[model samples]
Target: MLLLVHAALTFMLVGLILMVQWVHYPLFAQVGAATWPAYEREHQNRITFLVGPLMLAELLSAAWLTLHPPPALPSWSVWLGLVLTLLIWVSTALVQSPLHGRLSAAFDARLHRQLVVGNWFRTLVWLLRGGLCLWWLTLLL
Candidate 1:
């Protein structure tokens, strides 16, 4: 049950990250400078609403799975998932949040580009995590 929930959350996060990396972040520059601050603020707020609970759930589920992995799933895979989750959290705090903060104050093209590029780290991590989940799911069959 725990493994299933973890897999589902990770998969959902991967989908969200892909959209943010490819669609949402790139479009930030298209917003007019005068309205960019308000737009960015609203974006941040709305995204938090969507991402916050899922992130927390993912983190908790990853921790649980790490501590008590299912019999068929390898321990190393669970550890890797936990590590990926940590990297995602660290990247959000150190890289993405700062970029969002800067954009919230005022739109900067360079910062916008950095946000889009740096987001790939999270995107890739989530993708890897999702793959790990799928592998574990396959083991169940």
Candidate 2:
């Protein structure tokens, strides 16, 4: 049951990250300079509300799975999931959050490009976690 929930949450994150990476980030420049700071602030606040719980759940669940990995599962899978989860968290804190902070202060074209590019790492990480969860689910079944 826990694994199922984890998989569902991971899939949601994967979808959201893809949306943010390809669609949302690209549109930031169009927000225009006068309102960009406010727009970015709202984005940070609102997106936190949207993704925070999901990410927390994912992290907790990944930890849980790591500690109580299934009997049939290959040992490395759970460890890999936990590692991927940590990578996402670390990347968000170290790379993406700072980029967002910079953009929130004011839109810089160079920084905007960096955000989009840096976000690709997180997006790919989420996708890998999604695949790992899917594999675990299949193994459980």
Candidate 3:
């Protein structure tokens, strides 16, 4: 049950990260410069509403699963998932949050590009985590 919930949350997050990477972040440059700050602020606010709880659930569930994995699931795999989740959080805090802060003040072309590029770390991590979940599911079946 815990594994299923964790896998589902990770899968959902994977989908969202992909969309943000390819669709949303790339479009930041299209927002008019005069209003970019406000747009960036609103974007952050709305995305926080959408992602905050899901991220919390993913983090908590992943941590719990690491400590109390199902009998069939290997401890190493759970630990890897937890590590990946931790990497995502660290990347968000260290890399993405600062970029968002700068953008929230004013849009800079280089920073926007960096934001798009830096986000690939998250996108790739989530993709790997999602694949790990699928592998775990197969093991269960």
- Candidate 3 clashing pairs? none
The runs of at least 3 residues in candidate 1 whose Cα sits more than 4 Å from the true structure, single-residue gaps closed, are none
Candidate 2 per-residue lDDT, tens place, 1-141, comes to 888999999999999999999999999989999999999999999999999999999999989988998798888989999999999999999998988987888899999999999899999889988888888888888
Output the number of the lDDT-best candidate.
3
Q: Which of 2 and 3 is ahead in lDDT?
A: 3
RMSD of 2: 0.7
Report how far off residue 46 is in candidate 1 (Å).
0.4
Ranking of all predicted structures according to lDDT, beginning with the best and ending with the worst? 3, 1, 2
Q: Which stretches of candidate 2 lie over 4 Å from their true place?
A: none
Using lDDT as the yardstick, the better of models 1 and 3 is 3
Q: Provide TM-scores for the models.
A: 0.98, 0.98, 0.98
Cα displacement (Å) at residue 112, model 3: 0.3
Give me the displacement of residue 71 in model 2, in angstroms: 1.0
What is the lDDT, from 0 to 100, of the residue 77 in candidate 3? 91
